[model samples]
Target: MDFSEKPVLTGDRTVLRPFTAEDADTMWEIVNDPEVVRFTFEPSTELTLDGLRSWYGVRTADPDRLDLAVTDRATGELVGEVVLYEWDPAARGCTFRTLVGPRGRGRGLGSEATRLIVGHAFERVGLHRVQLEVYADNARARRVYEKAGFMVEGVRREAALRGGAWVDGVLMAVLDHEWEARARTDATQVTGEPRLYTP
Candidate 1:
């Protein structure tokens, strides 16, 4: 989707910008990290620079997908990434996913980055809903999503085989109304302005 033309989103510690071929190396590093890919769906072989570049080509060509490179705003260092996947134009909803490198872990970057992306998805992209499927054992990620106001809607028992054992998957979602209400509460607390949730 012409992501280069999309507005970059800024947060307290990070910036979300369009992903480019130049980011291949950074992505390769993270995607190959065993700890980083443990609970995720990344391929085991580890992506080579050439493979990443080719993947980037296909990703950038898809109009419905939005892939962003997460960077530390203060140092301009690549920290992680966020993606909005399986977008449904008619339904105006999509699945959200995120990953952080080792250096970016344990710093609340995941939660903060998610908040920023959720805001963009609802307020800027005009999406009706955002959803995600997280590994049941990934408590940290589940907490991040919960703190961002996504409700646990369902669970798939033994949905994936990880670490030589079956694991459940939890489905979470936040609707536009929920996001709007949260935004209103935030605005009222910060600016003393009354806001309403319209959608």
Candidate 2:
């Protein structure tokens, strides 16, 4: 895992790149969105603008994590972030998390960002697995995770509370072998070649 050299990962619709303090403006929107706040964090949690600025500023210094801003490829506007953190070196894996602001939602940017970052993890970092947890009620995010090759392991029932209601968190993960197969499938769509038998 080479954290020293962060790379800009591009996809059809979105680009994932290292963070800049200027992107803090978008964080304001993301942290305040009802859906982002309810699903990603405790409903009562508050994010001060100054706090977010400091948080995003030091992302590059962390040697064990990767925090990249997700931006629209065409507009170059910051949408959200795709992060690989909480690293377990012995396991050769890390926790994956992402979110898209209102401006970037409902357009497949989230899914594409998932694929771009996950691809970098498995292919470049040699991680054995990448895992994430989505609230059971957040079906949209679960679907996106599923589409990106993450399979549900189990439910952490009543693991979180939102609006005074307990919500289950669905644990999902993608393994190295699974990523390899997914990569082949993605390539097949482009070249129409059955590369499954190559390895």
Task: Give the Å shift of residue 157 in candidate 1.
Answer: 0.4
Measured by lDDT, the strongest candidate is 2
Quantify all predictions' global Cα lDDT against the true fold: 0.81, 0.88
Per-residue lDDT tens digits for candidate 1, residues 75-117, read 8888888888888888889999998898788877778789888
Question: Per-residue CA lDDT of candidate 2, range 1-199, in tens?
Answer: 6555577998889989999777787898887888888789865677889888898888888888999999999999999999998889888989999988999999999999999899888888889999999999998999999999999999999998788899999999999999898778877987798664221
Candidate 2 matches the true fold with a TM-score of 0.94
Give the poorly placed runs of model 1, Cα more than 4 Å off. Answer: 1-5, 42-46, 190-199
What's the true lDDT of residue 125 in model 2? 84
Candidate 2 Cα RMSD (Å): 2.4
Q: Pick the candidate with the highest TM-score.
A: 2
User: What's the lDDT for candidate 1?
Assistant: 0.81
Give the distance in Å from residue 194's predicted Cα in candidate 1 to where it truly belongs.
Answer: 4.0
